[model samples]
Target: MAGHHSIDYTSITAPYKELCMKGKGLGHLKNARGLSIEPVTGMIYVVEGGNTRIQVFSPEGSHQFILHPKFAKWGRVDLWGICINDGIVYVSDYQGGRIFLYTLDGDIITVFAKGFTTNKKMIIKMQQPMGIAINQKGDIYVCEFGANCILILENDSNNHIQTFHYQSPLSIVLRKDGSFIGSKGNLIYGKKTSAIESNQMIYEGIWATLCWFGDFDSNGNIFMSDMKGHQILIYETSSGRPTLLHIIKMTFVGSPMGIAVDRNGRIICVTDSKLHFFKGNTKAISMYS
Candidate 1:
C-alpha cells in the first residue's frame, strides 16, 4: 500500500454498509472498549471494559481466536486502550494502573507497572493508563487519565521522556511525523508531539464530539469514534484547517468505544462486544499497513 494522493479524503458520498452486526465473534464482548488492527494481516484485536480475555478477529470480521491472559492476577480488569506493533499486542489496564504486552500467540512478554523512571532518573508512577500508542521507533505514549497528562515512555517502555498536560484525554492517535490527535471531554484535536510550550495545536475538534480510540489511514486521513453522540467522524488535516470528510451515525452505536481502520480502508467501530465494518469512499492503504 502506497500513498493515496488521488482519492479525496474529505467526503464520503456513499453510505457505509454494515459488515459485522450479527456476527459470531462478538458474543463475549462486554463493553468492548479497546481495539487494534494488525498492520500486516489486518486482524482485529479487542478487549473489554469488563474482566475478560482478549479477542482476535479476521479481516472479514470472523471470530478467530480468544487469547487468555493472566486474568486471575487482576481482581477486576478495566482495559481501556489496545495497540498492535509488528506482531506484539499491547493493552493498557485502567483499573490495574499498568500495561501488558503479549505475543501474537498469546505468550506473555512483559508488564509495565508503577515505579517507572524518567530520563533524568526521576521516578514517576503512571495512573490510570487509558490510551496506548506505539510508534515505529517502539516508543509508548500513554494517556495517564488519573494524572491528567500524556506520558511519553521510551521505546522499551522502561522509563519516561516527557509529559504533556492534557485535560483528561480518553484516547490519542500518533502520526509518523511526530504529531498526534488527542481528546478532552467531548472533543478530539491534534497537537505536535513536543514539549508543552512548543506544542502546536492543529485545529481542535471541528465539532462537539467525544472520541474513544482514533487512527490514521495511509492517506493521512483520521478516524475517530463519538460514543456519546453515536457517530464516527472522519477528517483530513492537510489543508490549513481540518476538513470534515464524513459523519457515520448509526442507531446501534451503543456507546461506540474504539475506532480502527484496516489496510483496505475498512473502518471498524466497537460497542458492547459488537464490531461494525464499513468501506469508506476510498479504500486506500493505511500507514501501519
Candidate 2:
C-alpha cells in the first residue's frame, strides 16, 4: 500500500478549470461557497452565496442551469456545505440552521434536519451548522459550528442519535467503515468511538483562521481547504493518524472555502469568487489508483 512517505509531491500539478465571472446570462459567480460533484452525471454544483442560488456546470466547465431553491423566496439565505448522496442533494443553511433535501431538478423533498433543543428552554440550539455528511445507514452528521460539536440525526427521523464535542468543527467526511474526520481550528481530528483514546488529532499548526471544508479522494486521502491560509492541506489517513502528504498552495484563489475530490480523483476547490481544479501527474496516479 502506498503511504505518504512513498509518494512524490514534486510531480503533483493542479491545473485549474476556470469557473470565474463570465458576465450576465453566462452564469457569473459571486461569493461562491459550497461545492459538490455528481460522479454519475459528471456535473458540478456551486452554491453562490451572493446570488442565493446553486449553479450547475458541465464536465467541461460550461454553465448548464441554476437551482433557485424555494427558500430563496422566503428571504435572505446564507448557504454552505453541499453534498449529493444517492439522488438527493443536501445543502446546509448557515443562517437558518437547517438542512434542505432536494431532487436533482431542484424539487424540495423536505427539510431534512434542523436545530433541535436538548431541553425545553430552547436556549442552546444546534445553531450555525456548516459541513455535512451522510453515513451508510442514511444518518446525517452535521458540524454544528455554534454548538462546537457534530450532531447526528438518525435516518428518516428527527431523533438525535449522538453528539461529539469539538472546538468549532467546520467540515466532516465519513468513511466506508464508519470512521470519520472533521476539521476544527487548525487541526483535523478522527473519531471512531466514544472513548477519548479512539480520537486522534491529525494535523496541527494549520496557520489559518479556520479550516473551511474537506473531502476524501478515491484513495482515502483527505483534502482540507484552509480559508485564511489560502491553501489545501492533503493528508494521508492511516490507523486514525493522518500524515501530511502535500500542501496545495492556492495563491490564485482568494478565501478558499470548499474542497471536493471527484470520482476521477480530480480536486475541485471553491473560493469566495473562483473555482480551482487540480490533477496529479501520470506517475502520481498510481498512488491514488
Q: Which has the greatest lDDT?
A: 1
lDDT of 1 by residue, 128-172 (tens): 999999887888989988888888877574667777778887898
Worst 10 residues of 2 by lDDT: 3-12
Error of 2 at 109 (Å): 1.0
TM-score of every model versus the real structure: 0.86, 0.85
Give Cα-based local distance difference scores for all models: 0.76, 0.75
For model 2, state the Cα shift of residue 224 in Å: 0.7
Quote the positional error of residue 185 for candidate 2 in Å: 2.1
Q: Give every collision pair in model 1.
A: 10-245, 218-286
**After superposition, candidate 1 runs with Cα above 4 Å error:** 1-27, 116-123, 194-197, 282-289
* Deviating ranges (above 4 Å) for candidate 2: 1-10, 22-25, 112-124, 193-209, 284-289
Model 2 clash number: 0
